[model samples]
Target: MNNNFKMIAKTLFGFEEILAKELRNLGASNVVEGVRNVSFDGDTGFMYKANLCLRTAIKILKPIHSFYVRDEKDLYRKIYDMDWSAYLTADTTFAIDTTVNSENFTHSLYVSQKSKDAIVDKFRDTVGRRPDVDIKFPDVRLNIHIQKNQCNVALDTSGRSLHHRGYRTATNIAPINEVLAAGLLLLSGWDGQCDFLDPMCGSGTFLTEAAMIACKIPANINRKEFAFEKWDDFDEDLFDKIVESSLNKTREFRYKIGGYDKAPSAVRKAQDNISNANLSEYITVERENFFETEKYTEGQLHMVFNPPYGERLNIEMETFYSNIGDTLKQKYPGTDAWLITSNLEALKFVGLRPSRKIKVFNSHLESRLVKYVMYAGSKKAKYNKTIKE
Candidate 1:
């Protein structure tokens, strides 16, 4: 029997391409890209692997049903007609998450309530008992998405966002999201070819993520649990084999990854988290002001960081940004520096033209990922003239 089925991996804004590429690399078939999501065909073991290995995916959903509905009554009738027993038992708890973008369903909460009622009513009518709803820790999590009049119901294979990699127990002030950090590193072309640095490293998110990417480590190898583990068809032995296979694929990374933060507390927290991820051997955290630091390595460097967007920092934005540009232009040569920030006005103060600027979102804030290329020697002079204009 062919056990293959279609699945969708949801990702952050501007990460569909990378997520699709990741799925393809993971041996997925029929990979197709969507807005903020990628769809592909995989078996049950592949589903487990995707949950454990995909770095850019926020959630992996296995869509079960899709239909057009005119109103709530139509939705309830359709849901009630389906066989919920395949996914849930009378004793198994479940939760529903609904996202509605249609005139018929204005409130998402109401949609979730109706869907829950339908599922429970179906169970009670057929099996004489209904499963209790456990919102926090459900055996199965369902996703409902309504676009206009079309509704798609899916099983959320990932319980929480995959960003909860179970490695970060401590967070400093304004720590970047793990998924976003990994996506930014991938976007910056960081492939472990050179030394890496996050000058303003907060909580060492970039450092840990960069290390994992460089070493080809499974992204969620540190995750404590996935929703699919609670499924009735979950095969523990198959999952174990998949994990072992992925681990065997891990390659050695020769380049060094380092992080620098002026705050001692941040440095300590970063070190602790890196240890938690078992990556201390590949990464180092130090307490040093980025403005006072210079590039010590003679080889090429790849840097990606997110500086304070001035919401949490009290420093002058223009001077801070200008110093960043000055440090790169004068102190750092043969480096590619990339940073994401929501403060567009402050970015102007950097005084260097970004070689590439990609629009992305850090949660709700509209942000830009800007790249600066600092060439060596004669090329440095030409690059200086290019930025001067």
Candidate 2:
């Protein structure tokens, strides 16, 4: 029997292509990239694997139905007409999350309320009871996306966003999201081939993610639970087999991954989080000012970090950024350094031309991930050659 079905993996802006590539590598069929999303076809076991392994996905949604509606009345009628018992029981708890892009449905909250009432009324009319709504920890979460006049209803397979990777229990201020960190690392072309570093590693998000990628470990291996586990049709045996198989595929990582932070507190937190992820064997954290330190490793070095991006550029920030360029150029050689920051004005002070710049978002802030390549030979010789040219 063919159990294949369509599923959508939601992701942050500028990650659709990455997500699509991940899906294809995982054996997804008919992978298509959409704006901030990737749609593909897979089975139940594949769904489990996607939630467990996809590093760039925020949520994996299994679309059940789609329809066209004229108004709230039509929406309620269509929703109430569907067989809700297939997914929900009289005792089960569910929640509706609605997104509105249609002019007819202006308010999302009101749409959710009306849709909830429709489902509740359908159950009460036939089953003599209705499931209660649990907003925080719903057993079965549903997504309603209305674009212009079409509505798409999908079951939320991975709940609370896959960014909640369940590894970092302690975090510093302005910690990077796990998915964002992973995406940035991929964009920077870090494939666990050589040494990796996060110079200003706040809470060690980059360190943890880099180690996981290097070892080919599943992204959500440490997560406690996924929303699909709560579904009535969830197969424990299949999920267990998938988990074991994914773990068996992890490759050995021989390269070293390191992190450095000036603050003692940040170092401790990073060490704690790395230990929680069981990656202490492959990663190390230390307290050191990035500007005063030289390259600790030999050969090609791959560096990615999220530096402090103050709201507005000041003299202090300019000097801080300038020091970043000076340290990279003078102390580090044969290194590919990448950093993401929202402070575009401060980036000018870095005094180095970026080889590549990609537009991304760190939460709501529009940011840029820029890369600089430092040659291994004498700086003066390179400068002289350029001046002569």
Evaluated with TM-score, which candidate comes out highest? 1
In candidate 1, clashing pairs total: 0
Model 1: per-residue Cα lDDT over 6-110, one tens digit each = 999999999999999999999999999999899999999999999999999999999999998999899999999988888999999999998889988999999
Query: Candidate 1: minimum summed lDDT over ten consecutive residues — where?
Result: 374-383
Residue pairs in steric clash, candidate 1?
Answer: none
lDDT of each: 0.94, 0.94
Candidate 2 collision pairs: none
| Candidate 2 residue-wise lDDT, 269-365, digit = tens | 9999999999999998999999999998878899999988986323389889999999999999989999999999989999999999999999999
Worst 10 residues of 2 by lDDT: 310-319
lDDT of the structure predicted as candidate 1? 0.94
